[model samples]
Target: MKKSLETQTQLVSLNETLINELSSLKQVIDESNKKMADKMDITANALITSNGSLAESLTKAIANELNSQNRKMFGQMQKIENLTVESMSKLSSRVASDQTLSKVAGNQQVLAKRMDGLATQNQEILKQMEIS
Candidate 1:
């Protein structure tokens, strides 16, 4: 009978130890869950911040590229305009020179015709032996 009482006491002690171990395990699991939650929050915040920075940088780069293209286009347009104006000026001057040349050529033709008539008259006079 005393041995049976000793067995009962041992069983009760084992059960208490098991209960204590389970409570300790529960506390460890709760602490692990809290740490995991904290880590997840930290990671989430970092991602948000990184994304925001990347978006801002992307926007800024695009704006800068557009501005650069606009400036380049304006420069090209100015160059084209200057070239057009220069070509137009040269064309106008060439046209004026051509008109002057045509006027001179017409005068030269009239003079040549008069000289030919004079030569014909001189030849006829020579044939009559008026002037050797």
Candidate 2:
């Protein structure tokens, strides 16, 4: 019976040692998990900051490009407007000249009719003299 009691006490001590070792392992695992969580959080924050900066830079670049394009478009529009005005001025001059040419043609037709009448009268006079 004494031997049985000594064996029981040894078993109890062995169980206690195992429980302490398990507790220490659990504490080490918890500490490692916490450190890993902290590192992940810090990495996530850095990535977010970098993404924000990249987005801001892209937006500024796009705005700048749009502004440059708008300025170029405005300059082209002004050039087109100037060309249109010049073309209109030239067309107005051509129209004025056409009006003058129409008036001259009308006058030429009148002069031709007068010359025909004079020729007919001269021909009739010549015929009368020849008959006499």
Candidate 3:
């Protein structure tokens, strides 16, 4: 019975030592995991910051390009408007000139008829004198 008690005491002491060792190993593992977690968090934050700045730069560049294109489009529209106005003016002048030419043609036809009547009357007068 005395030997049994001593064996039990030794077993208890050994168990205590094993618990202490396991606790030390657990602490080391936890510290290593915490360091890895901290580095990962730092990397993630840096990536986020870089992405945000890149997006801002891209937005500004796109806006400037749109503004430039709009200016060019507006200039093209102005040129088209000027050309339309010029074409309308030219068409109007041609129409007015055509109307004047029509009136002059009518006047020339009436003058020709009057000249034919005068010639016929002069021929009649000459024939009557010759007969007398």
Candidate 4:
């Protein structure tokens, strides 16, 4: 009879533990449900606040803005093209001048060699005169 009573006491303790765990689980579920409800309420309020339709005048205004932007971009593209053309012309002129300068430098080198040869011939003549 004492063993039977001890078994009963253990069963009661286990039942109480399960009940406490269930209560804790219920509290966690309730908090989750409250958070979901708050999020849904915020979504609903945002939907209600921004209910104004994108009507005809607003669409026309957006179209006008897009057109204005397109015109400005096209004008900028034309300016870039003009600048490229002008720069290319200047580069061509500079290249031509560089070629002419290179030719002039070659002629100067040839003239220097000729002057050195003449000076060497004059020195040989002077040495011969001094010996005679």
Candidate 5:
């Protein structure tokens, strides 16, 4: 009986040691899980911040490109407008000169008619003087 009691006590002590080891393992697993969760959170936050910065950079680049294109387009439009105005001015000047030329031609026709009339009168006068 004494030997049996001693064996039983030894078995009980072995079971207690096993229970303590299991508890210690459980605590270590919990701490590892917590550390993994913290790392994941930190990684998620970093990804979010990086994505936000990338989006901002893309937006600014697009806006700058649009502004540059707009400026170029505006300059082209102004050049076209200036060309149109210059062509119109030249056409107006040509039209005025054409009108002036027409007026001068009409005056020349009137002067020719008067000269022809005077030549006819001089011929008649010369015929009368020859007969006298």
Candidate 6:
């Protein structure tokens, strides 16, 4: 009966030791998980920072490209405007020349009619004189 009591005491002591070891292991596991969590947070923050910088750079690049295209379009528009003005000037000059030519042609027709009338009057005068 004394041996049985001693056995029970030893079993109780071993159970306490097992409990302490399990507690220690749980603390170690919790510490490891916390460290891992901190590392993941740091990595995520770095990625976010990198992404922000990349977005800014990409936006600047797109804006610059658009600005360059706009400048080119403006230049082309100016050129087209100048060309249109030149074409209009040339057309106006041509129209003035055509009008002057038309005026000269009308004057020539009037002169021809006057010459025909003078010839008819001279023929009539010649006929009268010859008969007399």
Superposed on all Cα atoms, the candidates' RMSDs to the truth, in angstroms, are: 3.4, 3.8, 3.4, 17.2, 3.4, 3.0
C-alpha TM-score for every candidate: 0.72, 0.69, 0.66, 0.43, 0.72, 0.74
lDDT of each: 0.96, 0.96, 0.94, 0.89, 0.96, 0.97
Instruction: Note the clash tally of each candidate.
Output: 0, 0, 0, 0, 0, 0
For TM-score, the strongest prediction is 6
Candidate 6 residue runs with Cα over 4 Å from true position? 1-7, 117-132
lDDT of 5: 0.96
Q: Write candidate 3's Cα lDDT for 1-132 as tens digits.
A: 999999999999998888999999899999999999999999999999999999999999999999999999999999999999999999999999899899899998898898898889889999998999
lDDT of 1 by residue, 9-50 (tens): 999999999999999999999999999999999999999999
Whose lDDT is higher: candidate 2's or candidate 6's? 6
**Clashing residue pairs, candidate 4?**
none
Two-way lDDT contest, 1 vs 6, winner: 6
| Worst ten in a row by lDDT for model 2 | 113-122
> What ranges in model 3 sit over 4 Å off?
1-14, 117-132
| Runs with alpha carbons beyond 4 Å of true place in candidate 4 | 1-63, 124-132
Candidate 2 wrong stretches, greater than 4 Å:
107-132
Cα lDDT tens digits, model 6, 93-127, are 99999999999999999999999999999999999
Name the top lDDT candidate.
Answer: 6
* lDDT of candidate 4 over 61-96, digit per residue (tens): 899999999999999999999999999998988898
lDDT per residue, candidate 2, 1-132, as tens digits? 999999999999999999999999999999999999999999999999999999999999999999999999999999999999999999999999999899999998998898899889889999989999
Better of 1 and 3 by lDDT: 1
TM-score for candidate 5, residues paired by index = 0.72
